[model samples]
Target: MIGLVLAAGAGRRLRPYTDTLPKALVPIDAETTVLDLTLANYAEVGITEVAIVVGYAAETVASRVKGFEERYGVHLELVHNDKAETWNNAYSLWCARDLLTNGVMLANGDTVHPASVQHTLLDARGDGRQIVLALDTVKKLADEEMKVIWSESAGIERITKLMDPASATGEYIGVTLIEPTAAADLTDALRVTWERDPHLYYEDGYQVLVDKGFRIDVAPIGTVDWVEIDNHDDLDRAREIVCPS
Candidate 1:
């Protein structure tokens, strides 16, 4: 298995920070960037080979790819997502389908969280289960959050933002483990999602698999500190929790 990061979208809401650089390159601290921390986490988990899907301000990430690889002691693969500016992550992820066949520790570039989130997903892997998502059952869900649905019989039946916040089991923390067993199905699902609607998230691919009788399990990272940096407030929250007091 290897590390895979989807850092393609133009986070327009972030303004100046994303004006020149992609959101992944946005600094979380004086020195570390969102991509930096992601690579560090992958390295910590012993994943030495990492693939990053880049678009939007692709040059910025491309220029620094070598440096990031050296800094994290990991081999890097840069996948290009041409439709990043106009399409949602479903297409961005589909663009990586050819390269990520050996299973993947998939992460969204815009999210910031401790390495434990990755650890949880990796550790939660089971012999028969092919997909395991890092879920935050403790976090209070808002309408914008990608919520999960699970029951005693169905582990994770669905994952989407359209679900009512009051009934959601947890928030899908934008981190997932795709074992080799599920790669082909996930690729097909992603392709179908992009073909159907370019504005759909890769999470829609997960739901596709779930609806097809694929048992997507959840690893509840209880009370974990994490943030998805979508807007200015999220950036502040990331700094507060990701940086030491």
Candidate 2:
């Protein structure tokens, strides 16, 4: 299995830094970036080959590929998303459909978390499950977070940001383990989701999978210090998590 990162979205909320680089390249510390940590996590888990889906400020990521590979001791393959600025991540993920057939530990580029999150997902990769998501059951759910619903009988029933916070089981922390068996269904769902609405998130594709009777399991990452860097406030939280003052 390989590692996959979706780093296409243009984080307009994070200007200046995102002006020259993608959100993934935003510095979590003095020298390391969000993407750097992600690659290190993959390397730690014995995944030497990684595919990154790049869009907005694609050149910036392209320029750093070699350096990142050397630093992490892993090979990096960048997949370009032509519609990153105009379309949502459902399409960004669909852009790497071919690579998904190899099985992948997928993470959102903007999220900053330790390697333990990936370890949690990798450890839970059996039981005939196709897609296993890293869920934050310990975090307080908000309307803006990508929330999920799960039952004992039926894995994850729903995943969306619009759902009522009170009804959600937990927040999906942008980490997922997708088995090779899930590639076709997930890619098809992604295509359907983006074609139906260009603005839909990839979580909508997961919803499509759920509607089609596909089982998506969840692995809880308990009380982790992680942050999805969106605005300046989130960047501060990420800095504090990785390098406290």
- Give the whole-model CA lDDT for all candidates, comma-separated: 0.89, 0.94
lDDT of 2 by residue, 1-245 (tens): 99999999899899988887889998878898999999999999999999999999999999998899889999999999999999999999999999999999999999999999989998998889889999999888887999999987999999999999999999999999999999999999999999999999999999999999999999999989999998999999998888888
After superposition, which runs of candidate 1 have C-alpha atoms over 4 Å from their true positions?
Answer: none
Clashing pairs in 1: none
Candidate 2 TM-score, true structure as reference: 0.99
RMSD of each: 1.0, 0.7
TM-score of decoy 1: 0.97
Candidate 1 — what's its lDDT?
Answer: 0.89
lDDT of 2: 0.94
Q: 1-245 in candidate 1: lDDT tens per residue? A: 99999999889989899999899988888898889989999999999999999999999998998898889999999999888999999998889887657899999998888899888888888868788889889987899999999876778887999999999999998998988888789999999898999999999988898898988898898888889999989998889877768
Clashes in each model (backbone N, CA, C under 3 Å)? 0, 0
Q: How do the predictions measure up, each by TM-score?
A: 0.97, 0.99
